[model samples]
Target: MGWLALDEGYEISLVEGKVAVRRPEGRQLKALPKALRDHPEVDRLRRLAEWLERHEAACAAQVDTWMVSSLPVPTELLARVWPDGAWQAALRDLAVVPDDDPDEVGFLRDATPGGELKVVNLDGETVRLSPRTVTLPHPVLLPDLDDVREFAAELDITQRVEQIHRPTWAKPADLEPAATEVRDYAGGVFPTRFGLAARATGLGYRVSGGYATCKVRDSGRAVEAAVWIGEPYWDDETATGALNWHDEDGRAVRLGEVGPVAWSEGMRMAAALYAGRRIEEGGDEA
Candidate 1:
């Protein structure tokens, strides 16, 4: 953005998402000048930067929701939002499959004003696709995930919203039908329950009822995966507990009944919580 002239032959502009000051001679200063420290323009620019940051975060979150749920996104909507920097950043480089033809998978590259999409196919060719709707399938649902990852790597693709490279855990075939919880990520110790809960929330999971929970929509059904983090008032030492899933009605869901998205997300949350556990000496997890 261009610098705006202030009252004292000083120019101010946002640089690297911060207010930067420059002398009239065009020399930039390391810090904001003392005279203009309380300028209204500076405060306004700071607020604008804050709003931009929030907008970027919100755009990425919405894109993640669409990918995680494997929902079909309209090309028209994509085209409309393509001009926005935040939206474009969130949408670019995502692996998209046409709703009508799932085999036509490509990395999104551009969205035209006429609602046409330009993508890079697996053949190392830039192709134009005009699908009415496209799905950014979750990594767990991508049949050719390995191929896609390899292709993305070759293209030097990096997505603001995690999709292709997101960690995933698949449900085992030999699981007991009646089992309702997974103990793989259990026993992760933390100094305090508050610390464990903070870690879960910091990772974008919700803290409710003494559990760190993630809700996902899989196969048109709403399922919530929860990992016990201990009671809210438990200030002493705490440990992460088993991960479990429940249906929309709050009934416990058996391990075999959990959908692929729900299961993967559940395990992902559990693993993330466990990864933040306090480490003991010798580089061992506590």
Candidate 2:
């Protein structure tokens, strides 16, 4: 049997009648007969590939939310997600704080079936999951992880993935940030709060306190927009009836004075959010 490249965490090989896991490998199985394509081995390999793709996406999405909201994830939740290889792969390498403790952080190594977790501490020590909950800390929060932070930057990792090791700014990156635009929309346009938040979130905004906001580069200056939602609670089932923007000083900026890029982005955010609202007792559905 000839070995193929790595897939997920396994090496694959074409053996006997079909391509299967030798514990790792890839897609070019042209030599196998069409009838054997449905072989158990082939099917297992195919399923693994599909699962890996989904797992990677799920990991990234969860990490993004953790970064934006700093929400604490329960350790029980991680253990639950760990049985799935995709989730295990997505979670295995990053640093996590169990119980949001600042004293120590550990890199997840494995999750035990008995609801236990194995982690490698910064000092290269193996430690079990002890906290009831875990949080993926932003890099800036760890002042001692300068090496990890520097290495991540040298690799030019995307901020979304690197957020597991990167610090987030409480304020926009630009100094003395300003409001660059004032965007408006009628309440009828957006009916679901989640849809609007999702739109701004898709555009890199953080959703919190009934506001979908983002820091945008406007004419070489970092400007921010806090698009207001009708309610702050996630369960309220309300959309942003109308939206407004505030500068770093918390002052309002008129649309006429806003920069081009910020204006377009704010409008885009409003429109996208407005379009994504869910159908509720109506003829409209998407």
Candidate 3:
């Protein structure tokens, strides 16, 4: 195996039939195929592979990543056909109608050698099959069945592809396990982190069973506040507190509880207090 230092916080490790990403923290992130990572001229191949990956990601954002056969059609498009509402109940029998993309349909047909071939009628229905089965001739082919089996498959793929866009915000580096932070806070009458996040989000929290139980405003209503009381010490209903809350009109209600307020918020609050009055120099948020 050989290694090459690459630009932009990366180390590329190449073995006989594999290429591994040696992350900056000295961890192996992923292994790539030999064709891409283990060429005779490996340094050149690694650079090329990285560049191509970044380029494709950039391109996918601009061009809908779905509808790109290399990628898949987005599930959100299914929602467009079936937006959220009581009306969706009626569409229980309906199928996703795909747009006519000669290119995508042609590609699938070419890729599927010796697969079944059938001509679709002009009315966006199928004239093939003994029972005169109906179908829509868009790229997202949905087989017409009373059980709506094909529609379910199409919907699943669409949603899976759309999830690619969901935000994966990196957690702060100092995200200690909740139990440790909670235990320290529990030593005091009031858990420190619990107070801060509650104040920030306008919620309430308390410490019990080695965890901070808190409640927040959700959906314009209040509910139970949940704290992760140490698992071994907790009973099913004992750990959670029914949060006392008020509506905008000053009516009391219950909002659901959340687990120990996230430790990062607690850390930030602590740091803010430490840095008060601007006393010293280069201390960053822990």
Residue range 52-119, candidate 2, lDDT tens digits: 56667877767655633445777778778888755665566677777746666776778776767787
After superposition, the stretches of candidate 2 with alpha carbons farther than 4 Å from their true spots are: 1-52, 150-161, 164-174, 177-286
User: What C-alpha lDDT values do all the predictions have?
Assistant: 0.93, 0.59, 0.32
Candidates sorted on TM-score, descending: 1, 2, 3
Please state the error at residue 65 of candidate 3 in Å.
7.4
Pick out the ten consecutive residues of candidate 1 with the lowest summed lDDT: 277-286
Model 1 scores a C-alpha lDDT of 0.93
Clashing pairs in 1: none
Query: What TM-score do all the candidates reach, one by one?
Result: 0.97, 0.46, 0.20
Give one digit per residue, the lDDT tens place, for model 1 in 1-286: 9999987889999887888999989999998878888889999999999998999999999999998888889999999999999999999999999877788889999999999999998898999988899998899998878888998999999999999899999889999979999999999999999999999889998999889998899998899999999998999999999999999899999998999999999999999999999888888653
lDDT by residue (85-134, candidate 3, tens digit) is: 22223222222223333221211111012222222332334422211112
